[model samples]
Target: MKKKVAKFSVLPVVGASIFFYSFSTNKAQDINTALLEEFKTVNEELTFEVPYSPDAAVFDPQLRSYPALGKSYVAFKEALGFKESGGDYKVINEFGYMGKYQFGRGTLKLIGIRDTNLFLNSPDLQEAAFYANASRNKWILRKDIERFEDQVVNGIKITESGILAAAHLAGPGNVKKFLRSNGTNSFSDGFGTSIKHYFKKFEGFDTSFVVPDRKAKANSPSVI
Candidate 1:
């Protein structure tokens, strides 16, 4: 009898090929993943812009993306003035705070306004004062705004505009204390308005465009 010749079958070869393909694909993926992880960890201190959390975005959706202190910002502040003193530039609160934005004497001076009457009587002056004060406050709390914006503190989500508004309502010093204390150090104006109230009322507007300037003046052309 002739010796049986071995049958050549493709099945064993095909099985080995498939196994090698799968193993190669998995190994490639593992290598890519490791490279990506390394790239991300390359610089631990690298920072990036992040979206505001839902609760932190307190402005009306339409107002959320408005440029800082832009047209809509002007309108919002006008409405705020309306709420505060009926948009009456001449109205002085019982506490002696005057004008559309209800500024105090010290705050006016800080913004380079020496005449309370001019600050309250001139619409241009009032507008400039509002913008100047907002800028000054934004400067004072710049770091806090960066760190706390989009974060929840004392169950209230923080926003840049909200922080500025709070600083306006309470002094920047008070706002700092309140934020650092995580809402424990509550403050109310002589009018009895709380910092939290300002935070809530002024939430979700963009104040990031406001530059921090120690020399921010109400008479500055940019503010006016």
Candidate 2:
């Protein structure tokens, strides 16, 4: 009987040991499988090509490309357009100003742009309108331009392009006032954009392409 009891006890102990060994083996296999999965995920992530250059430069495809328009008429118009409407031809401001150069309805009529909707939709017409208005303003402020060109007023050097831009901001009459008063008779638009600001910002550009005409019309063959 003692021998049988001892043998039975040994059998249970051996069985328990085998059960613990099986459990530990399965747990180790599960842990190894989890580690392999984690490693695979990391490897997959690393396999993707990273955009890299020696200079670490990144390029955006959506951004507008600025070509070399150095001080030309194109440069001056583009610079003004960017400031007025971010070069968007269809934009209209809150104060009833229309198109890329932000022409008021009255100004548009003066430039022979009768249809406001047509002016808003047509890029060609808007461009023509800008040329006509600039020409008219140039004609109106010709004396002022000649008088003030190269003279420093309010610590800002005056230029023909600057005078034209100032006239665009605040009509030729107001520009004349501002220039005559040595920048003291300041004028700002509804958005508080001042003539002096435009004067300084748009100074020193070749506006010789714009021919001065008192009765300049957008639809006129010469302007178009």
Candidate 3:
């Protein structure tokens, strides 16, 4: 059985007020705890497509962390309220997206994620989100490298992993197009620090939440 920790006595060091505002006492704690757990478990199960180590997962130095995702996790936890006895695990928004990853119906279609029931219920959706993010990164990386190659010709320092990470967080196409028009630059102010903080936090997650069998069905109108 998954250990339940309710009634947050401490503000978790992982996020800011906006990142956690929507979560209740119980739900916030659950999300914080589960995030670490899921990271551990997923790394072991999934095969990474590139140079990332399951053993030593680090954010590529150039990318920003997903702040919106951390906030969304908190909000989803509060909305789902998994320990509420009557609540379900699905995170359904008014737009009809479901699961902790908040799979919008449109995103689901674009990503080719079928089985709406499983996507909303199974822990699998979390992995699905990771994969989707990875795919996005791949596209972005290609563009960054081409730009970086030009910089290399100019005798500038460049690294592939750094570009890979940037592409992952900021859409690669956007960054590439930006570089083509603008020029090489670095993250401004505290953006780099914030992302690093969240990357470490996200990497350390473990997801052992006791997914209730009954909750693993198609989303109902209510959180029953």
Candidate 4:
């Protein structure tokens, strides 16, 4: 009778142990499922929360640098700025050319920017000055652009943006002489940067945003 009692007691203990083990296993599975669901929710939120724009400039992840800006107007301006003052808005060269696009005091006066210090300090004013100057140059070289575009002068193909850039480098009158004389009338700056070099380097950019205005001014309603 004692052996029978012992066997029944052992069976009950074993059944309780099995029940506890099953419950613990189920509880662990539920915890893991909850954690996995939380991780997936966080991942989805992260994926959807980031904003994107098609026109925004993209940076190179591996190199941690800005790649080429393509043939856009942004590319043209930034590239010219890089070439001029290494894209520094506060830089003044030895020849007194100021700002990112390196405008001379005389040139700034032509664009209605009388205050040289204000023009140098204000980035918005500098940008407006650049646009204004480009527009004036475009107007000055309109005939030359129409005549020399796509034509190979001195083995370099002429483009509208290139012509404007050359005008920026050596003035519109010099650019006109260069084009009319088939590149023989080339002019260089104080740093020996030639008009032909500017023409070749800044070619093939979409500068159509610049309207040819003979009277373009920096403070004008149209420019700013």
Candidate 2 Cα deviation (angstroms), residue 115: 0.3
lDDT of 1 by residue, 1-224 (tens): 13332234556677899999999999999999999898888755585779776666356666545445543566557656876788889988888888888888888888888877566668988888888888888888889998898888898888888888888788899989988999899899876889998887788876655778877898743332
Model 4 Cα lDDT, one tens digit per residue, 74-108: 88988898899998999999999999999998898
- Our tally of clashes for model 2 stands at 0
Runs of candidate 1 with Cα error greater than 4 angstroms are 1-71, 220-224
Candidates 3 and 4: which is better by lDDT?
A: 4
Evaluate residue 167 in candidate 3 and report its C-alpha lDDT on the 0 to 100 scale: 37
Residue 95 lDDT (model 4): 91
> In candidate 1, how many Å is residue 26 off?
99
Q: What lDDT, from 0 to 1, does candidate 1 have?
A: 0.80
RMSD of 4: 11.5
TM-score per prediction, in order, is 0.64, 0.70, 0.31, 0.70
lDDT by residue (1-224, candidate 2, tens digit) is 99999989899899999999999999999999999999999999889777885885578788878779898888998899889899888888888788898889899878877788777888888888888899999999999988989999988899999988888888999988988998899999888898889989999999999999999899733222
Each model's lDDT? 0.80, 0.88, 0.44, 0.88
